[model samples]
Target: MIVLRNLTLRRGARRVLDEASAVINPGEKIGLVGRNGAGKSSLFALLAGTLHEDAGECLVPSVWRLAQVAQEMPETAQSATDFVIAGDAFLMAAQAEAHAAEASGNGERMAHAYTALTDAGAHDAHARAQALILGLGFRMDELNRPVNSFSGGWRMRLQLARALMCPSDLLLLDEPTNHLDLDALVWLESWLKRYEGTLLVISHDREFLDAVTRVTLHIERGKLTRYGGNYSDFEALRAQQMLLQQAAYEKQQAQIARLTKFIDRFKAKASKARQAQSRVKALERMERLAPVLAEAEFSFAFNTPTGLPNPMLVLRDVDCGYLPPVGASADTPPSLIVRQVSCTIAAGQRIGILGANGQGKSTLVKTLVGALPLLSGGRVEGKELSIGYFAQQELDVLRPRDSPIEHLTRLAHTVLPEGESRREQALRNYLGTFSFTGDMAYQPVGTMSGGEKARLVLALIAWQRPNLLLLDEPTNHLDLATREALSVALNEFEGAMILVSHDRALLRAVCDEFWLVAHGRVTPFDGDLDDYQQFLLDDARRQREAEKRARMQNGQAEQTSAVRKREYAAARQTAAQLRSLKRAQEKLDSQLHTLQMHKQAIEARFAEESLPVDEITVLGNELKALNEALDAQEERWLTLAEEIERIEAASS
Candidate 1:
């Protein structure tokens, strides 16, 4: 169990937690929630032993192994498989021991080391790492790619996979779903539910929290409070508490008001002076109850579109994907990702895009937004059709050096009427509606956090008075309050909308129908988010079974052909021998590739002069050992290739 006894923690002069206390029992999957800058991450830092509490006690079981995703962006050429496998500290240690024992040629030590390696799950480490990588949305073909080849979001997914790969008694995940698509989010939620260890995750996705967590730890006004159930339960119980608090505060205020009135009326009269003085003392002695100050409500409505265009946009026989590379031959065909995407965006329609990652959800959105041209299709737009597109990478379109007002001004020039008020004060007032007041309205876009930027994008979109909205993962960076606010705004948006989001809460609140972009086709899904989740689970199960069968056929091909032994003995023998040789060759190739990645990482570390002398020396020794091992592995690989070639030639 973990206990916080009147814990007081600080960041600089700000006391984030003052006499905050809570108790967390073993094996509890907890959701740590608070407003932005409310010290949720700070509390995690404290628990991870990276920060110390200013006062009181935060006691955690010392025997527990803690696992957390590193916040820093990784820069490495290591293969994804090796990178994730390296997360298992115990496995790494065991493997290192085995290597050292083998190098020393100590038979007894080698036996012990090998046993330790098996105990650390070295035999299936590759499979486990690949499973995590695939579960996080990486394609099987991309499993062996260098880590640095991926974009920032995909790299973060790799980091998450690495964290999940580590065995732990306690796991801490911060915004684990931010980069994930709905498919990956579903997979992770399922994985966490099955995790036997303690979990403490900080996320704004209420549905995810409700799905995985049984306990809620809330931080408010420098205090920590624990709730017995999930986020929904916490909201219900908190609302009740807030109501009770408000009622008590009102009653106390009334009594205080009556006492003050009596004292004021008779304080100057000699006859009542004694009574007045007693009342004064009584008032002074009273411990006033503070009123429950609810969080400020944030809600906004999209400006009524200039014109509501029925059937805002239409696509027929659309093949959505990327155009051929620059300077390509005129005969070259476009790379089609989704084919036959025929759809219509009618007024007041709310549609959610559903599919696994890389299943063309974003591609379809891009095509609808006119960011990608249809390979072979007819696209017709209504005369008054105005699109408010919120791209997944909306920040990239924003000018970093420009303030919110500047962004709005540029947008007004492009989309607003010719003579509309583009005045600084007017823009500031509009920005304030989205909570960007005063100096915040003039803050540089580069300096603003992700949620603020997302708000700015929405502000831009709302200003357009678009008849249709195409939002792709708009809530990725929003806090819970902002998400709820966005959801409310979207619900009130009197226009056609096609939304792509991993946030089930936002999806449920905004979308009336769902379009499943699967198998290169667009089709209407006949169910809600719950049914979609089950469908995803079923699809995943089927894929896993298929993969298992493939592995089995590959691994036991020779053993499974006993019935054909007599009639096709020679052919079967040759085929089995070739298959065995090829498998060995492939295994050797994977090992060599992994080793090369490690060697490159070491070399890159060596290039960094800031490393300590002792660390440099250690790296040098490791590099030398790696080189020797690589040489031996290369020789074996060469031998296997030669044998495979000889067998193939003989069979031919």
Candidate 2:
């Protein structure tokens, strides 16, 4: 159980939480939600023990083990498997001890160490770690690759995998779905459902929250409010609360007005003086109710295109991907992600691109938007066609030091009419429509939050009034309100669009059809999001079965008749030896267990009360000797296990 009592927390001069309290019981999955900069992350920091509360007490169980994804990028040469395995601290420590014992040539110690390793499930640790990696969209061949080899987003996924690898009592995940594709996101939703721990996750993805969380914790105006059920439920409940609050405030205001009028009309009359005085006192003593403030609503629409082009774009056997860099060898071939794609996107078409990560959804979008060159085939643009492309990374289109007005002014210069002069004031007014008002219009892009940058990108795209829009993961950094606004805008868009996003709500609300990019081909998907989810599950099952068969074949290939015959006689002798070694190993394990119990008892006694200096010194010496003997026995145990493994391998 976790409890926060009258918690007051601050970041610099900003008060994030004030007299806020909440209780999270064991095994409850909670969704922590708020607008951007509303202190969702700060609350997570407080729970993780990285940030202290300014006032009040936070109580978490002393025995609870917490796990969270690391924000810093990992720079290491370690294999991916080894890095993930390190998340299991207990297993890693046991493995290190077993290795040290084997080096010391203490047969008894090695035997005991092997027993401990087995108990920790060290034998299948690599397989388990690899499974996590695979589920996160890594290929089998990449398992042994160094951690430093992956890109920033892939490294973030590895970090998530590492966090999941740990056996934790409390898990804190902030936007875990940001770096995931739909397939991986679906898999993760299932994985999290099976987790046997308290989960506190902060995410703007509503569908993800709905699937994983049973409770919602909302932070509003420096107060924490707990609502039963998921995000949708919370929204509904909050709406009802706001309506009731508004009604109470209106009723109170009416009574106050009537009292004020009565006092003004009768205060001068001697007969009514006492009554007026009483009314004045009543007005003063009455509890005042503040009107409920509505949440900020965001709404914007794309500008109407200058011309609507029929058959906005056409791809005839298009090979979509990247070409070789300049100065490369003449023989270097182009890299193609999607090959022989033939499709026509007509005017006002809303097509959602669906695929697993690295399966060419972005590649196809880039090719269509002219960010990548087609290695072969043809791309036909319709008459008077204009394109607006939104990259998944906002930095691709936004300049860090440039203000929103500056960005808009530059864009206006290029697309403005021949006689129209660029006006800074006009551009500022246009930016205001997207929520960039007053000083915000002139703020440096470098100082803006991710959500701000995303809005800027959308504003820039809207400025073009293009007949077609190619959006790749456009809602990645947007909050729920902003996403709702985008969905509404897209629904009203008069242009054709190809959207690649993991945001199911936006896709469902805006897209009219779906095109799947898989296995280097583009094809129409005959079903909806739920069907796609089932498709991913079936694909994963098939892949697992295939891998199982491959492993079995590889094992068979390693064993031959001649080798088996030669090793059969040697195996019988080795088996007899292994039995004797196992008996000795079990005896050593018992001794080590007894020593551990004695050491623990001594430590507990010392912790409870003070001991005499002389007695403490004597007990310390005894504890040290016990540890040395235990190490030797563990080493002996490990040595025998290695010998048995070698014999078994040879016989196979």
Candidate 3:
């Protein structure tokens, strides 16, 4: 359990939490939400014990094991699997001790060390870590790759997987879905649902929070408020509360008005003097209800395009990818990530691109937008066609040192016809429509938050008056409010759009059709997001089965038919033994669970300090016996697992 009592926290001179109090019970899944600088991360730091409160107490159970994703990018030569496995401190420590014991030739120490390893589930740790890696969208082949070989986004996924790998009592995840695709996000949602621990997550993804969290904790105006149910529930409840508050304030104001009028009209009359004095006292004693202040709202729309071009673009037998940089060998061919792509995008078609990560969704979008040259096939564009493209990496489109006004001005210079260029004041007015006004228009792009940068990109796109928009993960850094605004704008857009995003809410709101990019092929997918999620699951299952088959077929190229028959028979016999051993292992697991529960109960009683000395001694001895028995069972379980692995390897 965690408790924050009258907490006052600060970051430098700014107060983040003022006289705030909240309670988070064990096993509760909480979603923390607020505006961009509302101090969600600072609260997480307080819980993690890295930040101290300026006043009041933040208490967390001393015995609870907490886990959180690392903020820094991991730089290491360790294999991905090894890095994930290292998350389980107990397993790693046990393995190290066992190795040391074996090296020292200490019989008793080796026995204890091996027992500890088994208790830590070291035998299955690799498989568990690999499952986490796969769920986070890492291909099986990439598991053995060095951690340093991955890009920053992929490395963040690794960090999330490692955090999930830990055996913790409390898990804190902040924006875990930032770099994940729809497929990986779905997998993560399922995995988190099955996590047997308290979870506190900070996310702007409403669908994700709705799926994973049962409670909502909102931070506003330096106060923490708890609400029952998910984000949707919180929104509904908050609306009702605001309505009631407004009503109460209105009623109170009416009463005060009547009393003031009565006192003013009858205060000098002899017959009504007593009543006027009473009314004055009543007004003086009455507490005034403050009117509820509504939250600030922002709305922006995309500018109407100058023209709508039917059959906006057509791709026939297209090979989409990037070419080698200049000065490279002429023999080097264009590297195609997607091939044989053929489609026609018509005016006002809102198409959502769906695929797993690294499956060429972005590449296809870039090719269609003319950012990359087509290696082969024809691309036909309609007359007066103009495009506004948003890249997934904001840096690819935004100038670091330039301000928003400068970017828009430069764009106007290139896009505007002669004698039609807008003045500086006019450009700033246009920027203001996207929420950039005054000094914000002159702020350096590099100094802006991700949400600010994304908004700036949208502002730039809107300024061009393009007939088509190609947005690749445009909502990657946007908050929920900004995402909502974008969705509304896209719905009202008069031109065509192709969006490659993992945001299910935005996709559902803006797109009417879906196109899938997979296995170097582009095709129409006749389904919704739910169906696509199932497709990804089915694909992952097939991938795992294929890997199993490949492992079985390893090193058997020259085997004769008779040898194969013998090996098959041996495999069947080994499988039978493994099944029997697995049943025994299950029974042992059940017994271990029971014994551990009983031991915990005993320890709890012992901690009460009310038990007699003799009784305490008896409880301690019983716990010792239970531990010994559990250790023996664990050792046996490990042996069975090793034997099964050996048989499977030999059969292969």
The clash count for each model shown is: 0, 21, 0
Q: List candidate 2 stretches off by more than 4 Å.
A: 96-120, 417-421, 552-652
Which segments of model 1 are wrong by more than 4 Å? 329-332, 417-420, 545-652
The Cα RMSD of model 1 versus the native structure comes to 16.5
Q: RMSD in Å for candidate 2, one decimal?
A: 14.2
List runs of model 3 lying over 4 Å from the truth.
96-112, 266-274, 417-421, 555-652
lDDT of each: 0.88, 0.88, 0.88
- The lowest-lDDT stretch of 10 consecutive residues in candidate 1 is 558-567
Error (Å) of candidate 2 at residue 294 is 1.9
Worst 10 residues of 2 by lDDT: 643-652
The residue-by-residue lDDT of candidate 2 on 307-413, one tens digit each, is 99899899999988888899999999888789999999999899999998889998899889888888889999999999988998755558889999999888888
Q: Score residue 146 of candidate 2 by CA lDDT.
A: 98
The sequence of per-residue lDDT tens digits that candidate 3 reaches over residues 535-603 is: 987887688668767876896366688997997797678779878977886677567657655765777
- What TM-score quantifies how close candidate 2 is to the native fold? 0.82
lDDT of model 2 at residue 356? 89
